[model samples]
Target chain A: AQTVTQSQPEMSVQEAETVTLSCTYDTSENNYYLFWYKQPPSRQMILVIRQEAYKQQNATENRFSVNFQKAAKSFSLKISDSQLGDTAMYFCAFMKGTGANSKLTFGKGITLSVRP
Target chain B: DVKVTQSSRYLVKRTGEKVFLECVQDMDHENMFWYRQDPGLGLRLIYFSYDVKMKEKGDIPEGYSVSREKKERFSLILESASTNQTSMYLCASRRWYEQYFGPGTRLTVT
Candidate 1:
């Protein structure tokens, strides 16, 4: 069985600052994928960034990036230049590399608050 | 961009009533998933459909059922609505690699 854990239940960051949300997972599978998702007040879950197990370099998308330590099963998301719009629920997810049989396992999200 | 749509944004039902939550995708994705989001627990997969007429039981599938008659549409069914079943239901469609989610349906049972 695979499980994802988000240690921080809540976090706060000032505008134009940076914040890091921690995530760890337990999986025995060799090939897998990790992801970060943002759910705004609109109730929509949007993909933020994704990292593949085979890749050693972390994934980056604009102001968001990930520090994926595959050996330690850690995949943390970093938000740079935070804005008020970044206030939302952030969830970390995991899935095996299998094509059709892949099912996402998510952690108990962390609520991010961006203050002015 | 991929777009997933759910039938309702909010739904209310009685304890013994049957509930149906519909989800449709416009990108013709091969995989559709149904997940439930609780406060302390992020999201748990209830069911997943890889193709038309092909369904798989996810981690939590105790009181849920699913139908995938068409490639682009997937439906989640609750045989008996209960208060414990009241949660945010999310639909997602996966293609190539990333999964696109729909604006969840918040269902409450009384």
Candidate 2:
């Protein structure tokens, strides 16, 4: 079974600063997908970004990006220019690319706090 | 915009009562999932459906069952609610990497 782990339980960042949340996974599959999801206080889960294991280049979405290290089995999320709205619980998820009925295996989560 | 809607935002039930949590998607997505969220424990998948009438058990499938009678609707059934089942339940629909989630239902089983 694949397992995703977010070592940091909570992270704090100053407004306008950058913060990185670390995540690691254990998967034997070569073709898989990694995702970053944000759950705000509103309790709505939102997709932050995604990275494909086969791609060497990291994935970036606006100020949100991921440093996906396939060799180390590490996928970390970087949030730049953090704002108050960026405060949320971030989850790292893993999924297999080959299966049509793939289910995401998620990390425990990292609660990010953006302080002004 | 894609939307996944849960039938109730909050629910309270007795321990022995049968509980049903309903979810509906507007994007006509082929995949729908039910997950329970607990503090510090993250989200644990209970069940998922790839197509109507087809279901699969997830990592934590014990004590939970799912029904997907229609393409847009997915329902989670708890045979008999227990205090341990109290948690925030999130519903999602997706085709690939991006998943659209509905506002979760906070269920309290007493």
List per-model TM-scores for chain B: 0.98, 0.98
Global CA lDDT computed for model 2? 0.93
In terms of docking quality, model 1 is high
In CAPRI terms, model 2 is classed as medium
Clashing residue pairs, candidate 1?
none
lDDT by residue (A1-116, candidate 2, tens digit) is 89999999999999999999999999899999999999999778999998988889999999998888898999999899999999999999999883668889999999999999
Give the per-residue lDDT digits (tens) of candidate 1, residues B1-110.
78899999999999989999999999989999999999898898999999999999998999999999999999999999889999999999997568999999999999
Indicate the fraction of true inter-chain contacts that candidate 2 also forms. 0.84
The two-chain DockQ for each candidate, comma-separated, is 0.81, 0.76
DockQ of 2: 0.76
Off by over 4 Å in 1: none
Residues B50-85, model 2: lDDT tens digits: 999999988789999999999999999999999999
